[model samples]
Target: MSLLNEDATIPFISRYRKEITGNLDEVQIGEIVKFKELFEALEKRKISILKTLEEQNVLTTELSQKIHNSQDFISLEDLYLPFKKKRKTKAETARLQGLEPLAKMIMSQNVNNLEQTASKYTSKEVATIDDAMEGARFIIAEWINERTDIRNNIRRELERFATISSKIIKSKIDEEKAQKFKDYFDWNEALKNIPSHRLLAILRAENEGFIRVKIEIDSERILQRIENRIIKSQNNCSAQIEFAIQDAYKRLLFPSLSNEALSIAKEKADEDAINVFTKNLKQLLLGSPLGEKRVLAIDPGFKSGCKLVCLNEQGDLLHNENIYPHQPQNQTNEAIKKIGSLVDAYKIDAIAIGNGTASRETEELVKKIFFKDKVDVFVVSEAGASIYSASKIARDEFPNYDVTVRGSVSIGRRLQDPLAELVKIDAKSIGVGQYQHDVDQTKLKKSLDTTVESCVNTVGVNINTASESLLSYVSGIGPKLAENIVNYRNEKGSFTSRKEIKKVPRLGGKAFEQAAGFLRIKNGKNPLDNSAVHPESYVLVDKIAKDLKINIADLIGNKDILQKINLQHYVSETIGLPTLQDIVKELEKPGLDPREKAKVFSFDANIKTIADLKTGQLLPGIVNNITNFGCFVDIGIKESGLIHISNLSDTFVKDVNAIVNLQQQIIVKVLEVDVVRKRIQLALVK
Candidate 1:
């Protein structure tokens, strides 16, 4: 299969295709695609189970099937009760140990002579009828428990019947930081509804000995069914055996099974949260393309002279200089001249002022100049610009320039293209919230990696322009190979074609197979490279061209001719209907960016102060955080707003993330604006 058309999921394509992916490489994309498939398949299996049981006559086919098909495992178990089997219990053991006949004799008619039924199964071991009947009772109980169907049913039933309990098991776990997990000491939410972040937090709290949690479920009803299935009581098992079966359930089985349910539910929540975060991150990373913009970036500072860098159409810094523009000594004249000259010389249209110290002042100066010139001013978040400045990537990319200069250029590129520049910085360093640094680092990395991968695949990459930092986030490629490709590019000079990328050190045929589709080569020797068609599947194009009696170009975009051919014949171990269908879609729109359009927004000059805000005012805001509590929105003023997690959506939102994401632009109404304390309570009305 061609790499572009290779239906070999993300994992298969990435692991095998090293050479083709380049910097916006392929490692993470495969995991996401594969996981998504796995998740879908699990949902299908869940549905299949319900359908099978419904057809078997044990359940009401229509209404019961609906409950079974739902993803809620607890609800499904409720309907599975009748078909469940009775397994071996103490009662079953009593029956099996030559006492079942005696038990049945007790269940039959008026038992005036109860001694008679017990005598038949008597031996030295069961010398008395009471002992015989007791042995029979044990056998019957054992039989109930051994039934697999009954076990499955009971497991399902107990999950819903369970109650989650939390206790402040320890007071001094973190006496210094006791407040953090204090709210969790008495948690009792249902397992099915608990949010992933909260669940992980509670689990962490429990692990640290700050709290103890236990799930309490109804075992009596579950045991009763088991008893009836095995003993068939017209009046069965001297009630004493019934008590023993109940004891077995409570003492032996229920605790472990209930815990299993909790574990499974917790897993499901984590998986779901990870998936959602990954999706949001992908969208944020690969968001709209600002196009090949020529920009001048300014890193605003006080003591340090404001760093300035001008990037060309391709994002390469063409000019770099420094100017002390603010604080104790603001070189207003010198700064203006330098900036004005560069804008005029490079025909620069925009100036990206970093949102740091002296930023608004810098913007003010730029705005004054722009009032008389062609350049416009914009304020960009310098979140991870400093981090990137100190990293090895910045050193290698701008070897001759100072650290601040590189940061300024990165700030400019970020404004022009977020995903591309943000890729250069560690996701962790892009400070969007509090506690981001202290949270579980490993968990954060996994989440960030997933997000980067999803974004890279969604936006795809321009093979020619993407840097190694950006490329490393691709599904299959990692930091090492991303460096190798850059090294190869430096040694080999500019690549004029995608095929040449395969020759880079460490990149082989397998890697190329996975990454080739996503990376594009504009105006390359082979038109297919500019599109997603892999080199391996060039023959398929050739065959199609030959069969159509036309050249590859003519066969590519012709819908009428391409639609007539049957795709099933192409299916194989290497290729399937999914792949074939993808090829056809690519033929229609080659090298499409899957990201959404980035809406342009500028801070309103009149609304520069929090005091200017009015009640019930509608404004555009950027999401600065997504926390368990709420979203913090930066609404152009110096102070950010609190869209208390409750205000993120109208529904009862468990996860604040589901309603708003970091860096998302949302339209909000100022519900209660305060200037005294500098607080603005906002709501996403729509």
Candidate 2:
């Protein structure tokens, strides 16, 4: 908490301050940060409520004490419900007629001859005994609604017994767009037992005007429960109080508590959806990288031709053109000759083809050609490549190029380093989420941003070669500081050491302390600059080297020597064995990427389209998108197949992630295929 209060980032605190944090991981620290902010917001709301109560002259000693002791928002709001300002209401109108005394008489159950007592309160507003009685009942109903115990009781009942039901709107039932939600047209389920995906689907149907959703419970039972608590005796006054209780239950309590219950359910659903998205996004961002390979990338198309770009080892665009290797232009010979010449001319290391229109055909063409040197062929997912191409970052990076050329460059770079190129595009646009648009956008963005930051910081960045977009995700450096770092590098040349990061504008001591370990400077003056070791511990490293009779360069990557050093000997009050152990691990392989090397995967050659697929046939596929229900796999065709949770294993499956991950290669047996609808069902084959 203290570290977070000092503006320290979660990655920095969890990684560098292990002694202070007792070795808490990033997820635990993030939970602490979330609750800390929530606590502060609750405190702020309490202050606002107190000031409002004081201004209204309703801050009694007991009420003030209750407000101060309230632990949750629902309880605090219940305490303030009676005093909350309101527009014209039935109770207010009855109060204007001076009927409060009669209402209190009925509530106490002490009134005899209630008709005569009601008649005594009659006036122009209440012209008869019946009118007065009705007005008094309205005031009594409002009082019942405001009671904390009554409202809480209703909430408890709703939580335990509520059922959610949806029905199609008769007028819109035949509409073409409404057919997609027909499954939910007449659905009923226990609210607590409904899955998040199903609930979200029903809510979406309601939002789209195709269905009317309702939350319901046993109203008669609830009414009896309320009457049991409120009625003291059977009399005329009890009958009048009973009328008020029914009015309150129908008009005020049920509606409020039902909506609150639905809101809580929706919030839980959103959290579930966002967690799945967060995990997929993290996996996609941390996907294996080909590691700075010189590449020739192609964005395949049929009529418009395949857009081709050659990127150097640094991913700088050296050349771009067009190749038509598909139908409508029988220029396969020309395309083949052009590709061969370019590969030889640039000494290409790999060929990355975007897995989009005419991808399989282009891969076959490229595979048939004879090149001078060995080159691996990769089909990269172009999920957000078009989005990134049209973005301002792409425009800034390649101002003179068109969207097609820029997209081809993005595909190639994604093959080389997915994290660096992906951070430049929006996480939502990458297409890993389920119902992303329906979830809370603000929370989704925050979670995705945090996942990107954690992945980037975990892998560590090369300060000299990293773009501003990638640099922005480094622990403490945001967009402005990242821009400043880039501008400083452009003006002064590549950074020679990690210490030079401090010279960038607006980068203070704290920022440097948090960011330095995650930003590597390769071949720097000090060997530790390229590792995950902070500069504050440089003196300690120097001392260790002096004791070993070796230089810093000799000590680094010397596993035999590093293992012999007693980490306990270096532990101090501020630094413990955890920190020392991490240092030794980093020393084993300084500046090593934690991600594995990207491998070339090939889909079955016989499968080209949905028409080619046969039931019970096994084929290779990649898991593309995941939801709470199942995962979608791209099986070398336009329609990705669904591997439902049940089909994922013969045993009971609890989590989809436990079965497969994003971009994971697996063999799946075809269970069913609907060519007209382009839906394919697959089962994971062990």
Best by lDDT: 2
Error of 1 at 351 (Å): 2.2
* Candidate 1: segments with Cα more than 4 A from true spot: 1-158, 165-187, 201-214, 217-259, 301-306, 319-338, 356-365, 371-373, 399-403, 428-451, 473-481, 536-599, 606-615, 624-632, 637-664, 672-680
For candidate 2, write residues 361-383 as lDDT tens digits. Answer: 99989999998778999999999
Model 1, global lDDT: 0.69
Off by over 4 Å in 2: none
**Which residue window of length 10 is worst by lDDT in model 1?**
15-24
Provide the TM-score for each candidate, comma-separated.
0.64, 0.98
Q: Locate the minimum summed-lDDT window of 10 residues in model 2.
A: 677-686
Q: What is candidate 1's CA lDDT for residue 498?
A: 73
Question: Residue 551 lDDT in model 1?
Answer: 83
lDDT, candidate 2, equals 0.93
lDDT of 1 by residue, 1-686 (tens): 24545444354354334434432234455555556655576577666656666577665657555654655544454455334444754554564466666655554434555666567778866677678866755554444444456667766775566666677866565575655787887788776667666777777777777888887766566777766754444343346556546654665556547777777866665565544445445555765555677889899887887888898878888888888877778788888888888898888867788877767677777776742455656677887888998899899888887777888988899778888888877776776533443345566577777667656766667766789877786545677877887787777766778778788778777667667766777777777776766667677767767877888777767888888867776656665555567677777677766655445556555576778888888888788665556777877767888888777776798877677666777888888976765678988865
